[model samples]
Target: MPRRFWGIRRLLRMPVTEAGDQYSIWVGLIYIFNLIVGTGALTLPAAFARAGWGLSTISLVFLAFMSFMNATYVIETMACANAVYKWKRIQSIKRDSVQDHDDHESDEPSRPFNDMEEPLVCGASIPSRYYSLDRRVELGEMANLFLNKTGRTMFYCTLCVYLYGDLSIYSAAVAKSVMDVVCSTIPANMTNVTDWDALPCFNSSSADPEAYTRMGCYRVALVTFAAAIGPFVFFNVQKTKYLQLFTTGMRWLAFTIMISIAIHLLIGSGAQSRPPAFDITGTPTLFGACVYSFMCHHSLPGLISPIRGKSRLGLHIALDYALISVFYLLLAFTGAFAFAHLNDLYTLNFIPTDNDNLFVKIIEYFLTLFPVFTLSTSYPIIAITLRNNLQSLFLDMTRLESYNFFLRKLLFPVVAVAPPLIVTYFLEDIGILIEFTGSYAGTGIQYLIPTFLVLCARRYCTTLLGLGVVNQYKSPFSNIAWAVFVLLWSFICVVLVSVNIIQKKS
Candidate 1:
């Protein structure tokens, strides 16, 4: 065999997981599906209406492909990080062996879930390397390993911004959904209401006129939401198995109700509705919404870390994307055809009408409040993730033990949860939040960061582990040109989104 193929053959002999390192593959898939299909999916129908069906379909398909490719890049870099760590460990063991003058030290077998089948002898020829994905290496730690000081700073900044945007969108959506559902006097018949703010929270309020506006209700709802969900950030909470199951169940129920109802409406009279084929002006917001809809790169590590077997991880993720993409298409198409005017949040389209049957009305309320249920479950987890990252960015891990509990635990969570909530206080528009978050910071998280990590990891791994080592989990799109392409795509998206925002204002 040629020298180039030798490492791959050796690497193929190892197992992807050990006996007790992670959970079953099915659970991992559920968590990923839940994370990827959240508030972003809720906004897709409105984006679809604005951009038109044909153009939206093409853009969505392409964006999903790019998102999946970036996901693979992150996975590949995780394996590289593992490889680097393992190599350093082995070298440390070798030096220790020399100091102790023990010949038997180098003869020990490699541990499971570590680098597989590493050379046992000191001063021997470097063998082909195979990095396992059994252990979880986070994107931040990967950045520390593969990126310089400036690169690490930029990575954390981009990640923090995207996560803050995520929390902001979640906060605003949940509050708006709750306020809309709970307020009876906000006009049940929304046909004549051009602006959401035009409706008053109550029929009559002479005590304080400003307090009667919908904006006041929204602020109250926002505060109530914060009071209810904010405490979860201060504690350590994991997404347990039952929580995943429950979230998945609620998500499916909500989607079924929305799609079935829309289909029924379309069959009756909505078939005559004519939507635009293509609208260039709407494409900028559409681009942002599509990118937002497919965002899972930032949370991939935690979700992918617990899978028991990962030899076919890429295949499994592809299937998840396929299912999600199909479901998104169904929801968007049904919605765009079923209603002449779509709400920014698609769930709001299902608000109960006065004439609705009792059972139908209950279902309508449930669908309308779907964002609250789904986003409520997610907000704490994202807040906690951001809090931990903030600590990593600010606190020195070497002196972590010296810090008091208040500074270490309480401050970061408050820091993470406060900014976005404050942001909601000033701006409650979900469309603007999604557009800026998904288009700018989201572009960096999804495209540029992953590209840079993989490129750096590949270089660092090759230098450390020798040229013959191979990473089994390497992305199929492994060419340097792919990295270049992703970078170029990110640049172009940022430029276009910025230009569109400017034109809209002018």
Candidate 2:
């Protein structure tokens, strides 16, 4: 029993260390590659088709958006660093006050939630457990802590948004890809000659409808078991090391594969075809998928952090943003041009269904494999968040040390899996889920959080100018301008989420 307990402790307490430089670069590259190859490439053609936009126009617009998101990451990282400093200062002030109290006074600080031992509202008033500076130093010393906890906390929170966004986008593409493959296998004459509504597969009311059953089952299995679990487990076990290796591979692979995909797409092939001008439903789904694809900015901080001295992280972030923008623009243009009118909003379906076309088959296979990888990568992030939340609640409420081990191991996984699974059952379509989740939840976390954090930090900048709170800076106009831009984007996201939900309900 003692040995088993020690083994569990070892598993949970594994420390994450920085990877070597070469591997770290690869990790960043792979992270970007996943964004480009995973689903974005598959979906862009369809999305542009629905938009009725020219290839050039679509390329330009997407590139501009990518650039903006990358820039936002720079601002956010700066804000997070500042927040850590502010939090430390606040802690210092509290400590100083406690130390200066009269000798006769009780050592305990006054509890804000309670007065003279009388409970204000509840059955038992909980006493606050604010830590002293000595305790803070001890905790910091215990871990090989370099980055402040506050910054780490923010980084992890952003990581959750990234993983969830990936899941939502990849799942949608997988569903569409499955449908395309199954439809291709069927005889055209049978589909046409039969009374379409009366056919078992086509009839919406059938016991096991083809579109809803076969494709849907495969999607759910891949998403729940493969994409969610695979990455989650890998990251939990390996963390930064896994990131380093993956990023390094991705950087070179992204440049090579992106060029190849572009060339193949430009020269017409069996898998590629032009899509229709406007399918309201299809266009929205495509847009949703694309938005989620761009949510890769969360990892920008990790990329920048390793570089020593003077805002190098910001420069790296800016460079990555520019590179990603170019990649997306090329993808959107080539894909749109390849499939002129027959564009399916989901890009995975654009690949040729034939088993013989090597490039097409390779891409198709990767599309199939992506869900498993995405889910696996995402699981660790969910576990970490769940563990943190549970720990916070336990410390605040129960204050019991005896059950900490059991709670950390047994409860965390259950909490992590249950909610997403239950939500998955109600959401039949991956496109809708991606659209709704990205526009509402992912957008706020990705765009708004960074902007807000940046604004908070910039408030203290010594160069003062202008009338209102927003306009008081050396770069007053730029600050206010960016703030307004973020606000507008956030508003649009809210509207998109609401409209999607309503459409789904109807």
- Per lDDT, the best of the predicted structures is 1
Q: After superposition, how far is residue 182 of candidate 2 from its true place, in Å?
A: 9.9
Model 2 gets an lDDT of 0.44
Cα error, candidate 1, residue 62 (Å): 1.1
In the range 1-506, model 2's lDDT, one tens digit per residue, is 22212322332232222333323443444444444334444456556665555533453455446435534534443333333333344445445544644434554444452342322122323321111111111111111122346654654454444445444444444444454444334345545423332234322575656545544544555455544343443223235446434544544454345446657766646435555445455444454545655654443333333332222433454465566666655666565655545444433333456578797677665544443344344334434443443344334322335567656456655554445444443453555555545666566555665555455434432222112212111222244676777778667656655665676678
Model 1 ranges off by over 4 Å: 1-21, 102-117, 120-130, 185-200, 204-220, 231-240, 395-410, 425-433
Deviation in Å, model 2, residue 404 alpha carbon: 2.4
Q: Which ten residues in a row have the lowest lDDT in candidate 1?
A: 113-122
**Model 1 lDDT, residue 338, Cα:** 90
Please report, in order, the local distance difference test score of every candidate based on alpha carbons. 0.79, 0.44
